[model samples]
Target: MTHEHAFSLHVPDLVFGRGALAEVGEHARALGLTRVLLVTDRTLRPLAPVTRVETALRDAGIEVILHDFVAIEPTESAIDRAGAAGQIHGIDGFISVGGGSSIDTAKGANLLVSRGGRIADFLPPPLGAGRTLGGGPLLPHIACPTTFGTAAETTGIVAFALDHGRGKTTLTGAPLRPSLGLLDPTALLTLPPMVLAANAFDLLSHAIESETARPFESRPAPADPARRPVTQGANPFASLGCREAIRLVAGALGPALDDPTDIESREQLMRAGLLAGTVFGMSGNHLPHALSYPISTLAHRWTAPDYPDDHPFLPHGLSVALAAPAVFRHLERRLPDRFAPVARALATDSVADALIALMRRAGLPNGLTAIGLSDEHHPALVEGALAQRRLIDNAPLTPTAADLAAILADARRYWS
Candidate 1:
């Protein structure tokens, strides 16, 4: 099998600091945007972060069209609604000011407005029309994340749920990436403790997965260099970011959660998120993220604190955390050397044990069972995880269906 000898790193233009969000309007004008669509969720509409961005944009003489219908976890319908708003307003650009859902909603809206098709037209087969995006340059987008996890601002992927919660899928390409990412630590001040814990775990997962993903040299070279996958696997440039992110999360997550007003800890956590985000796309993720899709899609009884209570919601990070310890334990046997840096960064001999300890400290769910899954759900969980080939294939040693099933079984309960 031929292996790749080259890799590429793509990151959005970034402005990071305490008050970086206040400068978004200047950047939007620099991008030549006159009228912009501001996408956010209803829950965040009255929040300080949203108000701050709105004030900044109007202060710069930019016309803002507010679209606050974004769901907690974005869905196809939500994306279409946001897209329709953009079309109606003839928005010249997009400014997303919430979590991953809001940013991804803006991405979907931008795609529909620029490419002139439904989201399904660009999705993969069996779930979508399997069409590719070549619709010329999409409108410029500037993403401001209120949460610290998903890193939607820095990625070229848009993940959303199918209508009625059938499942989750993604639209991926360079055009989907935001033109700039505004990292403002103060945006996290309103995050609840449980939400903060989930974010920290998600940050940890990004760093570890990037650090242990299949090396670029191990992947098959693309027949066309121009078509090289956005996720190029572990490379030298990404490793630098991954290691530091792991160390920062280890030291700062606890402090930040203990005191919501601790700006210093919040700043550290935000930096950790930024570092992890910049690199994870280059390396991709592995089993835990793949497994998270099923865990979230099939959830029937779990509800998280400080989230919209209208649905049976499981925050993305918590779902990923539930599967992480089991997945990492499975990987450690095969990739002990790769996990050494992670262990050193966490100051622990066993990465899985350290994760469990952290989860306990953060008051996270005990495991999959805690979230209402049982032995009967293993088949569906395994099948769902296997369907995420993009994430599954990035593992250094890809798992077979049976391997996934066993992992699910092991993940059922981490503690009594």
Candidate 2:
């Protein structure tokens, strides 16, 4: 029997491939951005690629202001500081030059610059402070992704951390998407081995979660177009992206992680990340993201949280990877049929087992206990997952607290 599906997907003008960085100047000129904020971190500064990006833009006569202090897991303060810098520099456009963290920070800055208010104030909650964004006149934006995850280059979503918050929240709307996306595989060649692995894991999680999440069904009619949210239904085009994304991640992560210098692997990972981002962007994610929060927050003990969300302390991708096997098993029980595509995508006998093995091979922690979550943490984690209405609403089987508890128990066992 044939299934029917309807959809709408929005992607910025995209320039992807080798030597694509050279097109930056032309793309910027096309966007008519004279003053651009080059949002990036200090680590990328020594690379010729960073210089190349600026030079290309400069040769095109675009005035560039560099925000070099972008932290690993950006904070509310960082977003504020970046927004203030954009205002002071009179930046007319934004060009993000690093991974998910840098791109998300740039997106947050744009929201403030275009809409008006502290990034925290505009947040709706879980992370948003509930105050509306007041930045005016959205500016032209471009993303030059150097990492293989988040796909912030093309999406309208910007994940951000709130002061003293438990997890990440996002700024969503069409205006948040960049006008252009520049994905050059060459830029990703320099990623550290750990980061490369973590990012690959992130892409895998996106594909799995988006593919296996509950099927979309009709809900109460929206009050109006403005109030309508994307999650209320699923789009077919996004599902295609999800399938391709899974295939790419499974095929690419191992080679890329083991051989960071392998340019081909890096390029594949980048494309996989973009495809995964596209899928998750439209279909939205569910359980793994929710389960990842507490685990991510815990990761701050090992490294600073520099990404948009607070729990991003673990790197959004890594945290998601750590939680995937368990999440998928739970999901498979809820919707056995959904796993068919995931199994096919991963070329495994079964989706859950495929993901479990993939996670192991990727060096992702096998279970919560392996990563340091104790039994004491399970209850709070369950509560946190419960509070994630956005993700929970998308779950194939709406898990109760007991269900979450059982999954955590499984995770504990898997770790040992």
Candidate 3:
């Protein structure tokens, strides 16, 4: 019955500003990268962000190999392909430019190239081989984010959809984090309104979930101190970042969405994403993020604007947003004290109501029904969410199958 008495925090070296991306070559050289794999998506390959990084690397005399086929919501096969490219090119380092997909793809590629295994070999059990990392040194990676959410640059987590309905799972460890992160706000200029809005919600949810996650003192002591999980639940270190992230999202998301040219807002949102990601890296997210995995996996008819339309897709933020109001309402009732600070940050009496209002302003879909789920989907949704035990267990109160079903049921429709 012993509880954990210690916690740890980890963050990659960070450079944040308007033109921070231009320094990629200098940083890559500092990391001693001679040949680097430049990971990005086809959508971003022609963009200024990718081009700028490529030019910077070449200018600094680093050999660059381009892998621009990263999927918008990275798939296991796609990541494997990226890893194969790195192996073939004998890349000594990685530079990921784009959103979470590109960064996560690079992480998977680094793991495979360094460890000589498939992505699943490093995942948790019942889904993969559950192998632990740290066997040897992984190639250095510098993550340059184009979007304002997911914060893949600062985290040690890599999430991707498993092939053939296996659903989504994650690989997490200290070795998976990027060697450094470049948060350049200029990359957000081309973001579509809906994409911007979705990113904002994701940042918002990360802060809230981390702020209210189970306390570190509530977790059982790890049998091996060295094997302490990346997500150790809430602690004082995480709370500091969470508070600022919530405030930034509240004040800046709308302005950033309304005017893509607003560099100030864009900078704020990027900073918020970094803070929230850093917090969640320590505390982890709970029900909303867990629910999002299934919601994203099961989405068949939903396609977001300004995203790749090659397949039916749901942005990660919208899926999280669909269930956030209901989940926070449950939390407010159960832990009013913890909920109070969040409400104050959002400047609302009800955190749930505030989220709904923000979602509407951001042009997010109303609920699960709007994204093609219904009462019949609840069972599968519950099963899918429960599989994300890593995130679900982080909640202050763990939800049962029945509880998850009820939450999905309540999430069916946010407003008429």
Candidate 4:
């Protein structure tokens, strides 16, 4: 079987390394952004570097506008509000200064301001076919990643809620990808314990899932660098990244989350996040992300003060983590050979077992029951997951209703 694949990777002009945030001002100027709308949540507003991002922009002679109203887990309404504010302020570009929520919100605002439409109007498959942005031009975006999850910086997928329509709608367009990404690990040092844990798992899930999602392949010689390998179902670029990413997450997340005070551990987590992002960003996310959306949309849970919606308020990383173990076990059965590599990355005898152990060590919940999923919600949950074909389409094995039914069923009895 061909283990090597060739594919073009879509990533921003990534500026990585320690203290990369200090160069934010220069990067913004290079993009010719005269004025920038700084998007972040209130909790992060007080963060020194988060504040410094704006200061750095001004120091570089760029006029800065602050819109720190980004909720922890932002909804479509929140994104619309921020976008309107960006338009009103005439932002030349956008700079996101937090984790996935803040970055996702900033991406949404840029879309609305540049594309001119309701968030739902741009959902997948038909995104760039004929969409027109009423706004003058596509404003550039620069993502300042402070946390170690959701490589929102390298991706063109802007995930937002569809409040009245009942779930999330994602917009995917290469033009929507941020023009630049400044990844600085130092900024994450001050994150609260829970936030760190949640985000780490989000990174972990991306790595684990992406590693196994490559489509099946028949034995063939490794292709030349320019020729991308053909897998039965998975994207080649995504598969390679997934393997490396899983290894990094397995080694980095635990130490980083356990001791946030240690810069080395933090840096490793940031590296892991980037690796996972680069891998899955191209390969595409599957079941865990798909399943998490409905639970997020339907759950009555409320997150931190920054997140004020009742729209199933679980964090993206947390939601994905909740469904991971079950999903991994289910997929493992379909692709048993895939398990060996994941096991090796995870440094365990079994991939599914390793993932469950990792979740437990990270203090993540074992199953949906831990997050309030019950027998009553099984039908709806299954329906929601099936509807997320974008994610399920990349699953290692084609999932059936019976398979999903058992997964959710096992999830209920998992830890509770």
lDDT of 3 by residue, 348-376 (tens): 99999999999888878888999889898
Model 3 is weakest, by summed lDDT over 10 consecutive residues, at 128-137
- Candidate 2's C-alpha runs over 4 A off are 1-6, 125-129, 132-137, 221-228, 303-312, 413-416
Note the Cα lDDT for every prediction shown. 0.90, 0.75, 0.90, 0.75
Question: What does candidate 4's lDDT look like per residue over 159-270, in tens digits?
Answer: 7766664777576666677888898889888776667777777887887777767453422445555433212234556666667767777787777767868788788778
- State the displacement of the C-alpha of residue 208, model 2, in Å, after optimal TM-score superposition: 1.5
Q: Which ranking of candidates, highest TM-score first? A: 1, 3, 2, 4
Candidate 4: list runs displaced more than 4 Å.
Answer: 1-6, 124-137, 214-237, 302-312
lDDT tens readout by residue for model 1, 1-416: 78899998888998999999999889988999899999999889999999999999999999999999999888999999999899999999999999899999999999998877788878877787888888367999999998888989999989888987688877788889999999999999989999889989998999999999999998898999878888989988898999999999999988988898999999999999999999997789989999999999988689987777897888899999999999999989788999998899999999999999999899998888898999898899999999998998899998999888888888888877
lDDT of 2 by residue, 1-416 (tens): 32323344667788889998888999889888899999998888778678989999999998999998787767788889999999888888999888877888888899888877788777665455787543244788888888877778877777765567556666666667778888999998878766777777777777777776665543444445454454533456677888888888788777876776888878877888878776677677888888876667655554422333443256777777767777778767767777877888888866767766766675666666666678998898888778777888877778899998888777774533
Q: List the residue pairs that clash in candidate 3.
A: none
Measured over all alpha carbons after superposition, the RMSD of each candidate to the real structure, in angstroms, is: 1.0, 3.6, 1.1, 4.4
lDDT of 4 at 49: 71
TM-score of each: 0.98, 0.91, 0.98, 0.88
Clashes (candidate 1): 0
